[model samples]
Target: MKSPLAAIPGAAILTLFLALVLALGSGFARAHEGHSHGDEAPAAPVATAPRGASSSSALELVAVARNGALTVFIDRHDTNEPVTDAVVRAEMPDGAATAEAMPDGSYRLDAHWSERPGEHEVLFEVARGGESEIFPVTLTVEAGAAPGPAGGFAAWSAGLAVAHDFRRHIAEADPLPLLIGGSGFVLGIAATLLMRGRGRGPALAVLVTATVLLAGNAALGAETPTPPGAFLAAAPAPSQDLARRMADGSVFVPKPTQRVLTVRTLVTASDMLGRTSELPGRIIADPNGSGVVQSSVGGRLSPPPSGLFPRLGSRVEKGEVLAYVTPPVQAVDMSDMRQRQGELDQQIAIVERRVERFRKLAPGGAVSLVQLDEAQAELKGLTDRRTALDNIRLQPEALTAPVSGVIAEANAVAGQMASPGVQVFQIVDPARLWVEALSFNARVGTRDATARLADGQVLRLRYMGAGLADRSQAVPIQFAVENPPSELRTGQFVTVLATTEASQQGLALPRTSVVRGSNGQSIVYEHTAPEQFQPRQVQVEPLDAARVLVVFGIGPGKRVVTQGAELLNQIR
Candidate 1:
């Protein structure tokens, strides 16, 4: 016979062998990656119920096979929100089936083959509105108990059985098997070149066949429980009780769990947020609408005629008397007052007697009428002096409200002594409050300002005035609260966001959305897919009191977690 190497067309043979080897190699790689080698130890039995999951750019789907039925769940890929009102159909081994919408937002299919143990390929057709999608998923179901080799010898025995079954299938002349065999045979003939002067065709044939069989066996043996491309661990498949960090560093959170956490998102858009500078500020009473009730001189404090002092938070009007300050007299002054009262009393007694005598004498015509009139005048003057002395000792200073507002503070008792020029009560109109912010630099056009409270409350502000005098190396800028709430109090610390003349353009996000990553880099969780949040490193600038501008690392039109971001970071 002609030398096989010389007779065999090199191009045709090489092409055929290359095609087969490539095909077989890819198949083996995929199978091995997804499954397990027969020689390796079996994977641990899943501790939870059997489940099948599939994902697409638009949706994430999972189906759990349970007692006599199957439960399916579908969520929006970008938001991880459950997709209800969707008609879902499934292709099972038996006839086709339709899933019913359950009250729990899941689809339920009555499957008779739920208990079947083997590999199953399911086709899911989901339709909602004008959009439709198909997902094909392969699920493996094993018996409740995991199987193992009987002994070490049984491992080889099982391998042999697999090989035997493969050989039997090859004998059926399937196109795939025939192609592989032909490729191996052609390659054997091609090997004859190396043995040009020797007779080793039989050995070459055996070697080629062995190599091909070895490769095929490795691919065929990979059928363990675990599959490849598992981004998340499946060992402890709890019922969405927890959010977890996936292997690829994405956050996996179920819809139900996210809802319980009240997770919310914000749509991103770019805009020109005027340049803002944050300043340490405090809540101040509006100067025009608030004032203090104080004593001009040192005196005792006493409640007004309403019988009690104006309580804290008590509403009072302008010029309302809130307290009385009884100016206490010194011991020396009291003694002088007593002496003046005694002298006036002696004079009053003499004038009273003289007036009585004058009236009697005038009636008797024994005294002149002019004399009687003069005596009466003298008695009246003496009485006036005594009355004036009594009145002077009883007068008390009244403290009044200078502005109409609520009482913000009170420091008064019925007999409390109020020192000179001391504030006894503070009246503040809560509806008319102002924020005093300290700016490191004099900022003109800082007309747009907002005050953010520590508890996430925001108050709109109108630019008032900036101080010309630098206070503590900074200028004091005042802003009036446009619509102040009742909860606001004077002297409350706050943060002020003042818009300067400059402007910037970027994505504005809630400050809470940006969090510190493990490496201390600033990171924001991006809604990359449905039920997936990927931490993206970002460069952020202060946009305003409540929002920060994302200048780099992330772009626009993506959802960023505004709420529950801290909770999401704790998932690991």
Candidate 2:
């Protein structure tokens, strides 16, 4: 009999081996599932179906020859913009031919060479104004395939069923769950071995583990169907209603629901123009319109004549006294004032007595009129000095508003002593706000700049100025808000869209419409058929504040989902 420790290693090895096998099998199933059942079918002969061309650069050329004439499509690699008014010269198998430009940015040439049924390489050179590109394309022309009998529908249906079955099996065969369950079973087996001497416990545990593994494997197998009917039942059927593929490769949403979700469409058209840039920005107070109120001298703070402190969000006129800064008087100053008051009072009394004597003597000719006048003036001056000394300890300085606007910041507290030059309040005129954006490119001029707030609100921008000095390798561009709403706050971060004089034409769609593809490429779902949406990779550029310009991948008149794209991307 094997020792318990020996059994433990065996159980662990068994579990690991089983997990590895399941994982390998799962990978194979996934690979098989992604392939179409009819992949082995021969390619169909060329026909007059609607043709399209895509390129990875400025030189993708697709030419179709029909009835002794050839039609060509030319597009730029990045933006998929059509190259119009280009002089196209193609070297055919027999001779060279010059193509004429069509209104739709395509070219056409009369087929002067003999019609042949073979693969031929055609060299094409396209020139427009100052730019030119060369494209080499191979065209294979063969006899059209004959139509099959109507009864062949069953075979097509069978092939679709098989493909779906493969997909279902692939989804079910994910091995992580199986590996976990297998680990649990092996642990149970080890426990059983450890308790070998216990009555019936080891046998019971072994039986239970075997039963669990068999059941679990059976469940995993049952998840995928081998027959056509089983596959149909397992897979979700494509709904008659229009559906779009989400970012995560999931499906099943209706068009009416999409419209309710604010789904908008864009028709792609491309042209060569200037490139745009998006920069991070923030909402700031206009320097000319915002001001901070600070105390000029240190003293205790008190409310103005209104007896109420100006609270935050309160509007105040320029130069309005918002608070009172009462200059604090020390005990020594108070004592000095009191002493001066007593001295002035005594002086006044002595002068008053002298003045009284002088007035009596002036009438008796004992004193001259000048002496009486002098004595009276001294008594009046002494009385005035006493009154002035008393009032100095009672007055306080008033703190006034520096600007005419709303109080955005208030740090004032009642009876709090404030230091000299300490900012007590910040005033901002909300009606005249500004946005500061950091631009990596030096902006020659701003044409149609706008700012997008975090809450999705967009503010119109008027160009103020661009700084020459570089900050963090970016220039600061200032834009004054044209119409600011109440929700806008100072120092709030925002996204600024600054338009340059250069122009480019492309399919402009809402920024939310594009999603990241599995391969990490930018992709948008094209409503290809009535009920199916195919993912198309696109090259995107900044268009404006709310939208992105699709330069490639789709064409004009195609439908796309704008809103609920993220939700669609979440579908598995």
Candidate 3:
């Protein structure tokens, strides 16, 4: 009853209606899909949208316009304290620029495109509050154009368009067109089988139609471009600007403006001399060549004939009198000495007269030869006792230096009374000093040793001996300084470096070259590209005073940031 041509138009209309429904369904599926794409929300039309504060506490930001310049203010999440003196950097559309923080925790910059229309994406890097936060905001300027319709068929169409865009973006995210193509091939087989009752031409036509649909889907999928946030998940390029070697074999550092940085360089060269082993050491006096001058007798101390008390660092010769000790005599001893002197004087007078009488009577036969001999011997003894009494009042014990060296310690005062056995001065030969260090390993027949002063001066050392006694789980190793300076003193603590028979090969770098990373790992910056620097972890061992032996993680001839390393680390 109905014409076949009439049915063809209806079937075509039905096919068009199904296609529209399928397209609409796909758009709805995409609109409901809820997943953020990188740092951006897929639903956000503008690339830069103000996100909810990720801070655990409060979020504060102050936007100020100063002298036609736009200034930004950021503070602590909770405390609202001004984050002054922070290193704030902004990623603008033009490029990166450092922002100067004002006194009130506000940052200012000249916004040349403030009057421009459209939404601008601003990325703020605020390094404060002991952490770094990236604040991305989209500022839309509505200079013209009224707000459009909020809801209606037009709004729905707009929403559909957005959904379609989202679906397209997702399609470009994966390779699913190949599966669709396989499905189309299977459909084509079914169509051919179903059309077997008809002519082969019709069946082939159906198969070709299915094949074309599959091919069209595949082609559309292949033509889709990647989404905006797809590249963010890719691997990042290595940072190579930290310690790059220059064209002239030197490191170029532009950190901290290169002015306030403390950068030092060491010129390298090779020479044929005795191998040196720098050791951490301290100044000490030679135990054998030094002595403390002490007062044995308790009495008032007086300067020697020089009339000047030996001060610290004064040079003194061996056997030179540093001070005099006047022994205080007791009253009983004084009385006894006086009585003895009187008795000796009287005896001397009596002996002198007896001797005279003996000499005269000898001629007259009044005295015998034995008596004259006894009288003369008594007179000689009396005269010796009288002479000793006179010398006792004028003499005092002189404290003399036992070593020829500088005065390492001088506790003497001009009229101060010194107790018995109290140390008055310590004389040490600074030129011949020694250093004592403790080593956990037992050092036997040490081949070499060295001492490094705190002022960066190196001292040559000769192995002296190692004590058998243990001190703090370590053996004491002593070394004699080859040629010490005048500044060396006794009882000064120093580190001693004693080399064993073992040897190791590695690149030795200065201690300043190594810096601790934020993750508590030891890292060193390696110069890779011309303007890029990457961090490399390293294992270090103590080599000497100023240098450390990099036992692992770094090769020779690599440009490392020896100077201005701290400044380079400040880069975000």
Compare the candidates by lDDT and give the number of the best one. Answer: 1
Could you give candidate 1's per-residue lDDT for residues 441-535 as a string of tens digits?
77546676887899978888898898999999999999999889888888999998887788888899988999998999999888765456899
Q: What's the distance in Å from true for residue 212, model 2?
A: 26
What is the C-alpha lDDT profile of model 2 across 303-402, one tens digit per residue?
Answer: 8898899988989999999988877889998898888888888888899899988888898899999998998888888887887777676778887887
lDDT on C-alpha atoms for all candidate structures: 0.75, 0.68, 0.60
Candidate numbers sorted by lDDT from highest down = 1, 2, 3
TM per prediction: 0.63, 0.53, 0.51
lDDT of 1 at 450: 83
**C-alpha lDDT of residue 446 in model 3:** 76
Ranking by TM-score: 1, 2, 3
Superior by TM-score: candidate 2 or candidate 3: 2
Error of 1 at 56 (Å): 9.8
Off by over 4 Å in 3: 1-252, 255-282, 358-378, 453-458, 470-473, 529-531, 570-572
Instruction: Provide C-alpha RMSD values for all models, in order.
Output: 16.9, 17.0, 19.5
**How many pairs in model 2 have backbone atoms within 3 A of each other, for residues 3 or more apart or on separate chains, i.e. clashes?**
6
The per-prediction tally of clashing pairs is 2, 6, 11
